[model samples]
Target: MQKQWLKWFVVGMLVFVGASICSRSVHADDSLQRVKEKGVLTVATSPDYPPFEFQVNQHGHAKDVGMDIELAKQIARDLGVRLQVKNMDFNALLVAIQTGKADLAIGGINPTPARQQNADFSQIYYYGGESFLVNRADAGKLNRQSALKGLKVGTQTGTMQERLAKQKLKGTHVVTMDKATDLILALKTHKVDAVGVETPVAKAYVENDPELKDFKAAYQLNPKDTGSAVALPKGATTLQTAVNHSIQTAKTDHLFPKYLKTAGKYMQVNTANTSMWHYWKYFLAGLKETLLISVCAVLGGIGLGVILALMRLSSLKWLSWPALSYVEVVRGTPMMVQVLLVYFGLGVFINIPALPAGIIAVTLNSAAYVSEIIRGGINSVAKGQGEATRSLGLTKADALRFVILPQAFKNIWPALGNEFISVIKESSIVSIIGVTDLVYELNVVRADTYRGVAPIVVVMVIYFVLTFTLTRLLNYWEKKMKHT
Candidate 1:
């Protein structure tokens, strides 16, 4: 009878696992089919780019409408597909299509050779040049591109501007600020002598700000240079051709110019050139830092958590309550508040700087949660396991190490992975303290170019790629560990 029951239980578990796999496969297939059947192309873009794409909060949820966005929508309409704009960072749009997460990227993306390796590009939509923006005082002194040779120039990291600075203006000291906006601030505050940015961006800035009127564009660098195009994933040949036809139709109708005027009404000139790429970089950087912090915190927290968990599970009330209270206080408050308290608030009482304070804060917070996971895992181990170890002449510590911990860790592995991912997403908040991770970069880009949408879309793609990659790696490790 017992054997029959066990056999039935094993069969049921196999069926459940098979069902889950099938369900996931079906969902993925359905998502792809729905796009084709409904004739709706989901294009991800960062609407932060002015004259390109930016958010219009007409009702409540933000709607993206800009030159590139309208162009994309028109393209979709031509293809008989309803255009669904998924607002994101520039960098993210590429990754979205690459990862089979989105259909295409349509935000003034320059179809560089490097990008083309991973994605296909439609015919060029917009042609533009790159230039440098400097303070009025500096502009006069550095009138020529050659004059900027020795001066510190800021540019959005990973853009064609950065590439130009490295290749064409080798001697010029280049500071890679995360965003064009931040570059502007750096110039405004005398942090950098000038910023290498696109021509339209510089023109928009000088036109919008009276103070910036003094800051002239120091001769157009890389004139009539690059063109922007919509990017589709490498395997998406059908989608690419459709997008190309759409671009051709839109150009004939001069739809982009009309859309630009409509989008320009709501966008601030200061935040326009913020592209998706800028934001993607920031988010990826943030994800990396968050992962680093989470790993360090989890390791530190596990060590401390184990000790606290043991104490809480101890017979002595005195030992248990203090540890329990520490856990309560940490778990009670939001992680953001705790992060601020440690990084900023505690600066009054303690002189420890930002990075260390952040590490300590995250570690403490992680420890509280780790303690609960540990406690639950420990409790899940049958009492017999502990008794068996004790009966074999093992001390409490030995029993935990040899018997209890092994089982506990296995049970909590999935939960630990979840916590790690959560920490990664949460790390964006650290940018508030000037941590230059991901979001900080986005703010900088937004401030300078005023091409709002592209940079943010870029940042989102980077983060998604980073977090998704990490999650996969962790899952692989977990599976390997389980087998071991």
Candidate 2:
């Protein structure tokens, strides 16, 4: 058994490593051609920064707006392709390019030396100033870089500001978050004393809210590292050249300033009505996707779980060992990591969209736990039930199918219901991959409104309503099954 397990593990590892190498070697230089062939230029961005990239509620739908989005449009037009924008966490933007999930990433991305090692970049499009956002009360004290000693400072993860905070601040505690909205939330709640942000972003936040203020803080920066550029996969010289051409044209036409002006108009519209009711469409769209993923994942998980449970119960080692290994491995890993691996890692071989990838990952993860519940329920059935079915001359397959599975399902229905409920809640993690689930829309609403806690409270209430309603239905069903 041990040797069989070791053999399977080694084989799995070899296949993964071999696939990774093939994927990299196969797609390294075809980035530009792929977009032309597909007739669509896919761009990935994190839309939480106002002037650079953000979302706005337009006719009950969230639309990507801001200078980065406008620049993406110009690049797509320059390439003679339609533009497809994907929203995700900022840190995942470059990964999307590297994995072939996107043709390029443009979310106010700074082309620092360290970042250049991972991905290629186009010519700089815009140079943004650096500023810090602090509470109106502390604006007097934290007005300059020197006053930040012993203070807690927040910065967006995988950003130039994060590097600046760590490298420049001598004694301040640096806290990193995945979203700019989250960092602002932290700063507003006093979780952090100050937040490092782009000068325009800081000014935008201060203008939208009375309690926030922006101040310049001196930090030595390389001139080359201060401007925003589009990121492409390493070795994608063709695509890099094309994007640089777009940037150059935009600069020559002075389009960036116009893009910023357009973005400002959308920002005004976003802030004009901060009520949750005005943005109900965003939440509704998110709820629809969340329920779709959860329903599909639950149904898929149950079907696969039944197969895996039966395999583990089989007498043949060949059938049982692999099933056992899969369950163990899946149950041991985190769901967030699994979602990323499925979306980005599997993306190398085939281009799977974010929504389907999220569903598949959740289904696979749920199957492991669901199979265990089924196995336990099967084991708890009386031995006499199997004997009686056999004595009645039913075949092994029919006996298990007609008699065993029914009873096992009845016994495990409550557990299955609990798993389903858990899926609805945990499915929020898919937002990290840009699935536009409730959490994703929550962040968008927060960014659009510039009111951190309100959107959070609204999303929390929505999740409660969903889960609470699900719990009630589950309890009712469990009771009905018992009575029957």
Candidate 3:
């Protein structure tokens, strides 16, 4: 009878494992096959950006227009695939392409050395230079770069302007905002002394707004400082070649310049004199902040999750109930809502000043999910193991600690790893709450430099690196757990 039970148990386990693996494999194969069979190329972009990929009401149907959008449509048409534009955040556009979620990212990306490592690029589409926006009153006082010393200079967190401000103007306190709109607000509110941004955007702000008319471009950024190009996912040579040829054709047909003219209208500035290299440093600086947010959120979430999980599983009803409640509430609501509540609502209601609301919200949200994972793990252990310990005269608590929880943890580790991967992606939502995470950084870079696509590509590569590393680590742990 004992041999029969053991044989059946082993067979059941193998079946469960095989089913899980097969399901994942099938999903992967289907996605790839669909792309080949359909022959429709999906291009990801951020439609919110003007002159790049902003949305237009064409007979009440939302259509995207801008330099990059038009360029991508041309490429898709030439390739004989129905062109599909997938609207997403500027930062997420590149990730979509890199992860095979989209065929390409043609969202006004600037080609940089760092981005080139993970993605191929088309020839330069347009070029623009970085510049600084300062109050009209301060403009005359700060003509040279040295004038920014000791002032609070604000830039979109991950942009060429931020990097250049940090490197070129030393001893200045740099406050990194997430978007051009926020940076402009900061400048108007006197939250910062100056804003370093791209020339076209700076000119647009000054010319478009009556209030901003008081702000002027104190200096035009040097030409060796900007660039712009389309991004293809790493290993997508076919797509890259197609995109390059399309760009050359667009330029020859005057389509590229015409699109730029339309895009330039939104910014209230001409891009004819914009240099490609001027924005490079800003993109690199923003890239660093994006990486920082992802890493910090993961570490914070894991630590807080373990604690919440333990509390939820505790014998004490008071601890368990509240922990369980927290988990339920956080898991039940949208992450975006939680971020806004934590950053804007809680701060307003409690009058308690806190760190960036984004970090706190992500940590709290992670803990709740982690608790359920722990609860499931604890429940999965065989009841006999605990009963056997009690028969040996060991206390219930001692048995749980010494015999049951360890094995239970091993069983749930892979699930925990999957959760970690989710947390990495979900961290992007923190940007909506004004965190200069990867997504926010990309927006800043795009708005400031007008290199819409490159910054998104850079952020995407960073996310891929992070998630891929986590996956490898999870696999290693799974192997070790199985061995033990």
Superior candidate under lDDT, 2 versus 3: 2
lDDT of 1 by residue, 364-429 (tens): 888888889999999999999988998899998899898999998888888978877766666666
| Sliding window of 10 residues with minimal summed lDDT for model 3 | 269-278
Cα deviation of 187, candidate 1, in Å: 2.4
Taking the tens digit of each residue's C-alpha lDDT, what string does model 2 give over 333-414?
A: 7999899988988887888999999999999999999999999999988999999999999999999899999889889988
* Model 1: per-residue Cα lDDT at residue 25: 29
lDDT of 3 by residue, 227-276 (tens): 66877766555556667888888878888668767766634432222232
**Reference-based TM-score, model 2:** 0.96
Ordered list by lDDT, greatest first = 2, 1, 3
lDDT score, candidate 3: 0.64
Tell me, by TM-score, which candidate is best.
Answer: 2
TM-scores, one per candidate? 0.54, 0.96, 0.50
Clashing pairs in 2: none
